[model samples]
Target: MPATDLVTAELTLTGRITTASNATFLGSIGDVAVVYKPIAGESPLWDFPRGTLALREVAAYQVSQVFGWNVVPHTWLRDGPFGEGMVQLWQEQDPAQSAVNLVATDHVPEVGWKHVLEGQDESGQMVALIHEDTPALRRMAVFDVVVNNADRKGDHILAMTDGHRHGVDHGLTFHRDHKLRSVLWGWLGDALTVEELEGIDRVSEGLNGGLGRDLAELLSAEEIGSLAVRCDRLRLSERFPAPSGEMSAVPWPLF
Candidate 1:
């Protein structure tokens, strides 16, 4: 669908997403479906400034566009039923496909996936956290690093039937501090491919041009500067970074 169609079309709230920490709704405009999160529905966050979650989501999409990876679905800010908020085109994911999974520790696949960690389930069975080692998902992991995403849970990744991995719920991102909690740690310590570095380069260079100008509307100077720093750091390291800071490397209730 054209970008303007979603932006201009009439937005109607069809259902509430009760599970989201912030107010979220499933909505539609004619035939186009979308996910909506109004700014007023945002809860106060200790680390992040209040009422900016929607903006950060839009910023993540902005960076995704620069990467040309479509890691985040097309997202933007607009006036909705409640007030101004973030709106993103809804993508129906394939139920059978999953980029990340919690599987029996003994049954962990020997190939096609990367092991993250092992822990016990609610029932006391040992399970391993793993994600598919595909280019599509790896691209998302790299994007998460560049954005300094603070939350990268498994449920946030949508596995499309055509092999595309779409990541959602990007409110906790682009912090001036290093709060990169995520479940995509499978590639930790791995050297970045040439293409991956090129993506980072594009974002870093764009910071001086159009992309940077676009982000200025949504982020503070410190946040935008932090974004540039992340890009340069990633490029220099040439590999996935290990978790740093006092924050846990992975999010709670990971899925």
Candidate 2:
């Protein structure tokens, strides 16, 4: 079925995703499952504009597509039961595979995984946080930087059964300020791969065309301009950036 039909068709709410900070619901249009976040349900944040969270989620998806990364799932803005909202096709994450994890400090993996940070656990014993070092995840990290993602919790990275990594919960993104808080900091200071640079180039070129046109509908002029600035900076540096703000680099709760 066409994506338009699926998004506009009558939706049957199956359940609420209570864990989400903003009100979110699981629904279906015919046989297709989707996650929906209504604009009216968004909680106000000091930094972001009111009622714009749902639009930001859809904007993130558009940026992901512009880069040709497909890091974010298919998402769009539409009217739902609660009013205007963001609707995204639900992706089933792999139950057996965990891409991010906490482990005893002594058992940190020597390869394949990147140890992000070390700290004390509840009992005061040393523990470490680690995440898989893969191209899929690297792409997502790059995507987050371009979008200025503010809440990239570990649980937000969905590891699919086929090994694809999908990033979600991008309601806090594309701010004029640099607000990139994330769990994918394993690539800090690393040189961007050729593929990654190419992706950045694609987005930079589109900022004045299709991508910019789409984003203007959801973001402010300053926000769209800041996004282009981020792409340019990343392209020029050709490396992952280190955190530079007074705010914490990683999100709270981790997952």
Candidate 3:
């Protein structure tokens, strides 16, 4: 069956993801499982305009595809039982692994991990936020920067059983202003690898092609321009960026 046909088929909602800030439902199209977020169900944000979240979610997927990072799952906009919404192919994450963790300060790994920050836990024990220093996560961090992702919570990173990582809940992306609040700040100030640079180059070159065209449909002209500027800036800097701006560097309730 064609891709469109698969998505257009009756989506039977199996359960609701109540933990999601927005209305999110788990459903299946025939045998294919998916996550659905209807445009009508999105709560209006003071910063982000209303009804555009679903489009932004789809646009994030498009950017991931252009960079060939496979960081985001297959996402698209379609009519569902609730209304028009964003639907993404559901990925089962490994139960035992998480991309980000709060380890006891002394338990922090000496190598192969980037320590983000140190803080006191609920029991008054000192803990540190750390993420694995791997190429897959680095790619996701880079993608988040380019998209101006504002709410990259720790739970948003999915660790697959095959060792691949996926980022989700990208509705808070692509703002014209710099609103990159994320927990993946482990690579700050590190130089971009040759392969990472090549990925940026690919995105830069493709902006005026299919990627640009697809984004134009979802974002305003100025937003698209801003995205292009971010790509060019990252390519020129050739390094992972440090947190800036007067706003908080990371999202609240870090989990």
Candidate 4:
């Protein structure tokens, strides 16, 4: 479908996604399915700016477009059934596949995967969090760092049948603080690849032009400046940063 149609078509609500922290709905703009989060339905947060999550979501998509990694799905803000909100093209991920998983500590895959951490499950069984050590997932980890994503629980990652990995639910992003929390820590401290460096370069160069102008509409000046700073640090350090400071390294309820 043409992108213009998505913006102009009437959005009809088909169902509700009960698990979302804020109000989220499954709907369609004609035949194209979409996920919608109304700004009015946004819950208050202690740190993030009030009622700005929808903007941040669209901003995340803008950043992803500049990166050319498709880390995030196509996202935009428009008026919906509940008024103004963020609307995104819904992606139907492969049902039988999972990019991240939990397994018994001893049975963790010795190849093609990376172990993140170990803990006891609800039933008291020892288990480990692990994810596929694929290039796609690696790009997502890098994307999370660039966006300062604050909530990267396991379920946020969608595994596509074609082997692509898509990261979703980007409402908590573009903070001017080090708020990154993710399940993609499998590549911590790894050296950045040439292609990865190039992607960062694209974002850096774009910041002074169209990308910068677009973000100015969705994020505060401080938040946009912090994004540039993160890009510079990523380029200079040339490695995945280990979680540090007083902030928790990972999100709670992992999944």
TM-score of model 3 vs. true structure: 0.98
Which sections of candidate 4 miss by over 4 Å? none
Span of ten consecutive residues with least summed lDDT in model 3: 1-10
Query: In lDDT terms, how accurate is model 2?
Result: 0.93
Which lDDT tens digits does candidate 4 get at residues 106-148? 9999999999999999999999999999999998999899999
Q: In model 3, what lDDT does residue 97 have?
A: 89
* lDDT tens per residue, model 2, 74-191: 9998888899899999999999998899999999999999988999988999999999999999999999999999999999999999999999999999999999998888989999
Question: What is the lDDT, from 0 to 100, of the residue 102 in candidate 2?
Answer: 91
**What lDDT would each prediction earn against the true structure?**
0.94, 0.93, 0.93, 0.94
Residue 4 of candidate 1: its Cα lDDT? 78
Q: What is the lDDT of residue 77 in candidate 3?
A: 91
Tens digits of per-residue lDDT for model 3, 81-194? 999999999999999988899999999999999999999988999999999998999999999999999998899999998889999999999999999999999988899999
Ranking by lDDT: 1, 4, 3, 2
Give the TM-scores of the predictions, in the order they appear.
0.98, 0.98, 0.98, 0.99
Off by over 4 Å in 2: none
Worst ten in a row by lDDT for model 2: 1-10
